[model samples]
Target: MKKILIVEDEKDLAENLRDLLEALGYVVVKVFDQAQFVLEYLKTEAVDLILMDVMIKGSMDGIKLTEEIKKSHPIPVVFITAFSDQGVLERISKGKYEGYLLKPFSLQALKSAVFLALNKHAILEKDLEGASKNSLKIRDKGYVVPVSQDDILFVEADGLYSKIVTIQKTYVLRGILKEISKNLDPKKFVRVHKSFTININQVTSLNAKELVIGEHIIPIRRGFYKSLLGLIKLN
Candidate 1:
């Protein structure tokens, strides 16, 4: 069962929602009217979903609270608002909620929206885990090989596959260059060429046209040269 937090100013409506969620085999962790209280509670509590009201009787609105929560950690938020004005809709869109429901929503709609939000949130977490470079698992032949971030020398793009070059050997994996580049640690890996992402720690020499990492000579595109040089110089 997933835990849910309800942030609504209307006490009667909050109770109704709690009862509905409880009946649907979901846990209602807390019903908070103010944003600060919710934030304070979350310091020690874990919740899977948040049902938030767009307008609340407090200093901080639901959108602002969600923004603050996202900076530290991301939780699926579903906005429930009575206001149907253009301004309210605009604010809801800016919040980027997984789902939204108008006032006096049906039980079926609420259930579907909540289920979709939770399912999507789970998928997002799996994608983040896959993209993270902290002890990445790469499929090498028939074995799943674990590679540390510090062990990588550079990544070179082959037509549709990517080559992970280490001090020992090179491994070919099925992935695009651009997607592979985004998964690497930005501080350690720098894209000198359109088809190559070089580990700064492995780079021994650099110039306007190319950069040398160990024995490999990687070409640096003219478009990426100036900005890359400037960024390195500033650092």
Candidate 2:
């Protein structure tokens, strides 16, 4: 079930909405009268969707609160406000809202809005999941070793075999450099030299022709030097 957050100043209306949402089979994680409360809550918990009333307590209205929430958490939002004020509607139009429900809306109308918002959110979450497949299983000996792309520090092409180095240990598997690198994320792992491939995250420091990871000093080949430096953004 999709988790929803209700931000409404009206106590009775908030409870009614919560009950209605629960009846519809969606999980109402919590309700807040103030936008500030929601901000604090979001710090610890993850919400799938937000049902925000346009008008609320505190200086930050629902729209502005949504903007703040979006800076870090880009979740789907549905506006459930009583007033269709021109200014509020304009702001809502510019905001990342999936649906808008006018006050005095029927339970069916509420259901439609929430259902659509969560459906859109579900698709987005699915896409995100597909993009974050940053892990690989290494066929080491009879057993298999699972490793995260981010955890891998470097790989050295050792003739017929490749040496995989992680934060903790190193494994020499029977594979060529090109074959072994196909399992890693291309964006995070790059060939710095003919024999060395380093993870972008593992670079501790770099100079004109070399990068250091842990105690290993990987040389930057003349052919790959410029491209290697361009890929890494050092502070």
Candidate 3:
């Protein structure tokens, strides 16, 4: 069973969330309001996802706590906040979180968010396991072939299929861009456009609009620029 941690302040709400998640077959751990306790618990136990409230009884708020957690753990976090203001959202966006739910959200919405977060995290863990093998498994002509992740330059969406471009050759995969990208290492690859996901290690140069991987110039969509920048260091 998947484990989940709920860092909520309100006792009643925390109990409700725990009961709901437990009923759904998840192992739920609740930290009433202490950020420190949550951090300490994580050192000993592993959880698949975290449900954090923006405002909690601790020295650091949920946003800051999440930031600290990301530095040490790659665990996915879903923010539960009452605030939906632009400033609060922008601040939340600066952190590495998987999802967020505004106040007054329905139980169904909460369930969906939890399910999606867990599913996405599962994909990331699977990809990380593949990365440890130093190659990606691709289906080709009824056979599974291994491709070096380092050799991959970029991926592009082509109608119903996604093309994986490598230094040697390109492989046409039988999935959409989003589906294909879920298998790549998040630290090594990033989606720069709706139609493109590039290997950051292969990037040669970048401008405000596009990035270069050898001779291939990939367009950087408006919202994705920040994500690409976060993965690379700028001198």
Candidate 4:
């Protein structure tokens, strides 16, 4: 199920919204009169979207909170309000909200807004994943080579640099394994060990402790053994 965080000051309305969204099959976490608390939860909790109210009783208004959240979180936000003044619309637009619902909105309107926002978020995420999978450029004034994720059979960390092994070629990079792992698609690539990140699709065979790709052997860390199997099956 997709998780959502609802931030509104009105208690009765918030409860009603929670029930309505829950009935629509969305897991909703509602916050009343506390934008700061919602912001903190967003840092650690996994939420797919946010429902924000413009006017609220808090240290920071909803507009500020929305701006801050958008900078760091990948989740989409929908602004809900009964007031439809020009200034409010300007502020909401400035936040780049996925959708906006004027006050006294119907249940159907709310449902439709949430549905479209989620669809847009999904599209954006897929585009980002595709872009990351297609290219990995050097981060610094080093030999910047664009390595296709498909061409990379595996990556082995050598100090601060990683040695990328492909089906027909190999290259060295001046970044750590964790740094490279961020740009790799989780569906296709996985970190099998602290020192190695392997493309699960390229893996020819796997043992209890090592993955065999042609003549090369990549060690699978004890803690990541189950995850490795999951990735292999996923790919």
Candidate 5:
């Protein structure tokens, strides 16, 4: 079963989230205060995902807690917030959160977010476990690209197509971001910018403003900066 850690301070909200997740067949673990305790549990056990509240009673806010947790553990996190102001959205997006759950969310919305978050994590784990090395057959082209996962440097959107760039060559395919995202390893490739996806291994370094993949510089979108940092550092 996929285990989840719930980090919300509100008693009623926490219980409601726990019940909802449990009903959906996910094993839920609730942590109401002191996110630092979560840091320890993460070290000892593996958690599939986290549902964190932006405003908590604890000493650390959700963003700060995420920063600390990501330093050593890179589990996927979805922010739960009551405020949906543009400023808050921009801030949350900077964290590269898997998804967001606004307060008073419907059951369907919460479940959908959970499913997406888990799926993303699963894809990412596959990449880390060597999904990249597997040969991918291009549909109907009879063209089998001789590429290893390690050779992949980055994947970006070129107009309406998705371009897979490796150390040796680039492959342009007909697809949308969602379609391509399903095939690539999530752990290895992340959509940091709206138009670009990058291989985590190819990242030589990350500046506050841009991602450096060899000589190529990719600008980090304001919303994906935090999540990108987590992936870069954790991986």
Candidate 6:
């Protein structure tokens, strides 16, 4: 069974979420309104996912707490926020959360978000575990080619398809950029734009706007520059 942690301030809502998740076969742990308690619990236990409320009781809000937790634990977090203000949305976008649910969400919506978040996290974890020997399998004209992950410099979205660029060649795969990115190792690849995911190990230079992998210059989307910077060391 997958373990899930709920960080909501409302006792009633938290209980409801716990009941719903538990009924769906997940082991749920509820932490009502305490950011410190959540952090402390994480130190002694492991969970597959976290359902975080935006305005929990603490000096650090959900977005800030999520950022802090991600610095040490890469556990996927799905924000459950009632606020839809521009400020809140912008802040949430800047954070490293997997998904979000707005106020008064339906049961089905909650189910779908949690399921997708957990599923995406599972794919990422699987890819990370296989990072040492995993190769992206691509179908060519008649044969399937195995492209080693380390050899990939970047992946670019081409409408419905994605172009996987390696050191020597590029292959087109029939999948959208978002779907393809979830299967890549997050530690090795970062989505710098809506249309580009690049290998950090292969980056030669980077600035506020773009990054270079060998001879190719990949544009960094507005909000993604910070994400890319977080993966690298600075002087």
Quantify all predictions' global Cα lDDT against the true fold.
0.86, 0.87, 0.87, 0.83, 0.80, 0.88
Shift in Å, residue 219, candidate 3: 44
Ten contiguous residues minimizing lDDT sum, candidate 6: 226-235
Model 3: per-residue lDDT, tens digit, 194-219?
89999999987787799999899999
Q: By summed lDDT, which 10 consecutive residues of candidate 4 come out lowest?
A: 137-146
Look at candidate 4 and tell me the lDDT of residue 136: 73
Question: Model 5 misses residue 29 by how many Å?
Answer: 2.4
lDDT measured at residue 216 in model 6 versus the true structure, 0 to 100: 97
Q: How close is candidate 4 to the true structure, as a TM-score?
A: 0.61
Error of 5 at 117 (Å): 0.5
The pairs that clash in candidate 2 are none
Model 1 agreement with the true structure over 43-117: per-residue lDDT tens digits: 898999999988877899988888888777688999999889998788778766788999999999999999999
* lDDT for each residue of candidate 2 in 1-235, tens digit (9 for 90 to 100): 8899999999999999999999999999999989879999999999889999989999989999989998889889999898887987899999788899999999999999988888887898888676557766677777777777788899999999999899888888888998888878888999878898889877878887889998999998876666777888764
Model 5 agreement with the true structure over 173-196: per-residue lDDT tens digits: 788765776777677778788778
The residue pairs that clash in candidate 1, if any, are: none
lDDT of 3 at 130: 62
In model 1, where is the ten-residue run with the lowest total lDDT? 226-235
Candidate 5 residue pairs in backbone clash: 93-223, 94-223, 94-226, 95-227, 96-227, 123-186, 124-186, 124-187, 132-149
Candidate with more favorable, higher TM-score: 1 or 3 = 1
Candidate 4: list runs displaced more than 4 Å.
137-173, 176-235
Per-residue error (Å), model 5, residue 84: 1.2
Tens-digit lDDT track for model 6 on 12-73? 99999988898888888656587898888889889889999999997978889899899899
Model 2 has a clash total of 0
- Model 4's alpha-carbon lDDT is 0.83
